[model samples]
Target: MLFLKPPGVYAPQDDTSLLTTALHEEPLAPGARVLDLCTGTGALALAAARRGARVTAVDTSRLAVLTCRLNARLAGARVRALRGDLLGAVPDERFDLVLSNPPYVPSPHPQLPRRGRARAWEAGRDGRALLDRICSEVADRLRPGGVVLIVQSAFSGVAPTLDALVRTGLDAQVADRRYVPFGPRLRERAAWLRTQGLVAAGVEKEELVVIRGEAAL
Candidate 1:
């Protein structure tokens, strides 16, 4: 489905495509509840809706929320797009599946961006700021047997994510991985990332991994 990406809204990129592919592989039943956190253009949400699941998409950016809503309408898919942060968007909702392609690029700054295009990728130093929160809180948002598919850079510590999810009582593992060339942001941060030991010197590519965590029945 074609999505309208306005200025400041994150366009669907490698990580997004990878997560969407993983979402398609899941055994989603009709009317199953699904939530797409940090949803940018509602790509995964729309994908689930196309498969007959009820979908809700949440993002921290207003532009992202608007873009997702518009894209959902154009695709003739039902999606509830809301502007809010992580699990806080739908506090009372539980889902059979949760999808997120959140910001995972480690930034030089410790504080996250409050607005602008940077919010799409400028994660705090170590890059696990949002990833950690999601791992810790998402299980509570899942119905028994529900699953979450989250894509993040291997630079952001994939093993820790799996460990956290397991600590939450979910069966977790690395579901998919792809080596993608550094994007403009990562390329710009290459020197800094090297200095921080997050990447090897002269490395121009990063490994992205999709971690799948399934809530126990």
Candidate 2:
């Protein structure tokens, strides 16, 4: 599928691919409702739509929303693209599956960016800004037996995510993990990560993990 990403919109990358793989593993019945938070290029949403699921993709960036819509159109996939903060725009809706690849890179900045390309990857100091939000609120938007697939770097606290979901009465675990060399963002933050003890000395690779959380039946 052809995706047109304007400047400032995040292009699909390893995290996106990993999330898509996990999405495919789910049992998506025909017409199952799927929600892609921080949808970016809408790759996962389009993939779900192609599987005969009804998909809705949400992003905080307008450019991202437009890019997702264009990509969905190009792929001949039906997806509702909305521009808003994660899970905030669809408060009344519940879905069978929820997918997210929200910003998980630790940023030098203490707060998330209000705009610009940094918003695509910068997630405050610990990179848990958005991840925590998802863990806290996603269960509420999931129907009984619904599942959520989320991808994040190991630098972020994977166990915390699991604990958060468990506390919310969902079964959560790491469904997939891949070791990838540092991307440009991580490479640039190597020094800070070392200072923060997020990375070991001279470590150049990080693990990307796809976490699956299922709402109680």
Candidate 3:
């Protein structure tokens, strides 16, 4: 799907390819229990709910949570939107499938568009803050044979992400990818793109890497 939107947009246009692929790959499957992490605009949860899944979406921003709740109500989907960072806000619970499109931009700039701790596009100090944490905790929060799907950017390269998830004992796979144009920080990622054979071809350093893996049983 195309996820086009205005620049510096607070929320993403689409729910990311991982969500769409997950829906196509596994789908709601009757009464599936789903968890959507960092649900910026509730797209995944709402979509899954439409497919007959009971979804609970969590975000760190109150505005995001409210937006999602309102959208869910409007769409007549049984989706719960809660405000919380990562998995803290929700009570103890497990789901058949867990999904997230966490903040993946790695930046050295102090002043970013969304500067809030959890709302920022990139995790602070090497950009591995939230991704690492999520990988480490997913195994425990997931049920037996549960699936964990995350959409991370290849900004800093996919190797780091693959290594980290593998280190967490999850068998990772790149389910899908998309080439996006550089919006704000095009120059910053030029060198990295060159290594990936993207820059010399006039392609910008914007891309999405969707990963799928099951929690250790």
TM-score of 2: 0.98
Alpha-carbon runs more than 4 Å astray in model 1: none
Ranking of all predicted structures according to lDDT, beginning with the best and ending with the worst? 2, 1, 3
Among residues 3 or more apart in sequence or in different chains, the pairs in candidate 2 whose N, CA or C atoms overlap within 3 Å are: none
Residue pairs with colliding backbones in model 1 are none
Candidate 1 lDDT for residue 12: 86
Cα lDDT for residue 36, model 1?
94
| Per-residue lDDT value at 163 in model 2 | 97
Model 3 per-residue lDDT tens digits across residues 1-217:
3322222324653326455666668745788888999887677777788888889998877667777787787777899888887877666888888888777666554343344543547665355667877887776677777888888767655777677677777787887887766755446656654665545766664677777877667
The local distance difference test score of model 3 is: 0.71
Question: Residue-wise lDDT of candidate 2 within 43-68, one digit each (tens)?
Answer: 88998999999999999999899999
By how many angstroms RMSD does model 3 differ from the true structure?
A: 4.2
Greater-lDDT candidate between 2 and 3: 2
- Model 3: colliding residue pairs: none
Query: Ten-residue segment with the worst summed lDDT in candidate 2?
Result: 1-10
Q: Each candidate's lDDT (Cα)?
A: 0.92, 0.92, 0.71
Candidate 2 off by > 4 Å: none
